[model samples]
Target: MLDSDYTQRFLFDDTDVRGEWVGLERSYAEVLAKHSYPEPVAQLLGELLAAAALLVGTLKFDGLMVLQARSTGAVPLLMVECSSDREVRGIARYDESLLAPGATLSELMPDGVLAMTIDPTNGQRYQGIVALDGVTLADSLSNYFASSEQLPTRFWLAADGRRACGMLLQQLPADRIRDSEEREASWQHLRTLADTLSAEELLGLDTQTVLHRLYHEEQVRLFEPRSIVFRCSCSRERSANAVISLGQQDAEQLLAEQGGAITIDCQFCNHSYRFDAADIAQLFAGAGTEGPSGTRH
Candidate 1:
């Protein structure tokens, strides 16, 4: 059986190629449990979650990577975020009435733009956008890497609502001493081998078994696997800071309209935070000196 909720990185011993495999199980279940999403939405979110985890594994940074799609079709918005620490969270906004059985990617998000953002812990943010022109999320992401990063990348992603899994292969820059034609041929050979991978195999096989099945003849090095978990970064302090950023006048007005207390609910984790009049007073009083003092539920 596949080892779920983990990402493993691998490399080719003789080629400038690297790959990553991500399998999501417990983390996927945790995200789905927070909301009663429809079948189509849940499946799409699962795929995105897998993609985000795979992408994060490729980068060597201490930060967060977000994959988001915005559209006007049955599903208006889908987003998934994975931090360097391996915490994952995702949410989808859609119209259930329009979602039918076996809805395709275009049917769920027609005329959409897919954006990937990388926010580092101590550096400027970078974002890449591509049109959602493919039938699958994998296709669009492949296009993004080709255009934005100028890298030859391929992805195979699958999700069954219960388990989400994906594989990514990237051809790194060739060495100056290496023959250009030889490197090109090697890249094509590996890509062709990866192309033979089926969604069923990706979702069903463990990392070791899958790699051996695909590249038994080649020298492939597998790294230690990293665990992925469901975690929400939302807290009452952040919510309080958001409220304080609204300024004292507007904050008080919102509190008055809400019957002397304002509640903030995290869309990703369904965590609720409540701040009463006294809490608001303390927030404004210690605005610059301290953090929010609201209660979390």
Candidate 2:
């Protein structure tokens, strides 16, 4: 119950393969609540959110991991950001009238490109880009790993309007099974079992049950599960700084155009930050005069 939104990792004991499972319920609902998204858009966002979480689980960093896709089809853009703390938020842009029932991923995102960005707080940022040419997002991610890092990775992602779930299985460096043919056999065997996993089972079953169902005869080592929550990193102070970036003349003109105050809204959270005249003055104040009295709604 308490672990409704979490990620669990496992190692196929004595093998070079590891896997992760991510399920989102409340966090998905919270992202859905921020704006009114069509069914297809909502479903895509959910999958992206789950995918971001799944990828971030294997990474060791002290910053943000972002998955962004830009397409030439109905869905022009979709993005999901997950922090090292396991917080995730996502948004999708789409033309509802252009969407059709049972549209394939390629149809929804023709000629699209997916970018994975890892922005470390203390180090340089790294980004990997892949073409979204597969039947699903999972396929595109697998392609990314294949082309970019040459790591053998596979992903299974599913998202309804209500919840999102995903699984990740990757082949690590040869440790237990060194023979190339043996490794290939092991990977195929594991993937064969994983292929039997349905989206419904992934969404409904617990980690232990899911693992048992897939790897009934394998030696698996389960790790501690981590919690995932929905969080937007928007702040009134950042909003105020945005106003300051507009410069004195433009900021004043815009304030005047907006009836003596300017309102900045965060697209991710839809939170409004209102800055009045004195607040503006405080923002453009030279040196460390004082902070603005901006209010958030």
Candidate 3:
């Protein structure tokens, strides 16, 4: 059976090329369940989720990778985040009336700016931006790699309401033994094979089966797969910190206005946290401490 919510890496043993395959089931459904998104919005968000997982799997870092698109079109913003540990969360904001049936990426987000941010726990953050000039998210991302990273990369992404899946192929830098012409020829050959993959195959087949069907004649080596999961990093402590940032006096004033309590809701997971006046007072009192002040959930 195909393993849902996992990513597997593969490489051409004889060429400077590598790839990653990601399939999402439970995680995708969990994200959708949190909101009543429209069909186009949900489908676009799913593709973004799959893209984030594919990109993050290519790196070795202890941080979060964020994929964001901003535009003044039908879809104002779409964001997806994936952590190094394989935890994923995403959300989208769009104008329903503008979303037409069977809309392409350009129709939904005309003149959009796509930004990818890498925020590491122990290092400085880095970001790259590219214009949404392509009709599909995969094409725009491929353009990003060409302009920003200067690496040849291609992506095939597909999603239904039930599951989201994606495949990525990247050409690595040539080493001393590999000549430029030979590397180019190898990349061309691999890309030719990858171009034959269909959305139906990507969404329905297992990683091993899909790779074999595409690169059956190539020297392909598959690596162990890693599980992906839906996990929100929100907590009462983080919410309390947001409240504390408003200052003690403002927090009290807000509490009074809200009938003796302030409610904070997490947009990602739809988790509600209520802080009463006493809770707010105690939270401020413990603000001087070096660690998290409020109770965790």
- Note the clash tally of each candidate: 0, 0, 0
Candidate 3 per-residue lDDT, tens place, 62-83, comes to 9999999988899999999999
lDDT of 1 by residue, 85-184 (tens): 9999999999988998987898889999999999999899999899987889898888888888667888889988899999999888875318888888
Please state the error at residue 82 of candidate 1 in Å. 1.0
lDDT of 2 by residue, 47-129 (tens): 99999999889988899999999999999999999999998988888988899998989999999999999999999989989
Question: RMSD in angstroms, candidate 3?
Answer: 2.6
Which ten-residue region of model 3 has the weakest summed lDDT?
288-297
Tell me which residue pairs clash in candidate 1.
none
TM-score of each prediction: 0.94, 0.96, 0.94
lDDT of each: 0.89, 0.89, 0.88
TM-score of 3: 0.94
Best by TM-score: 2
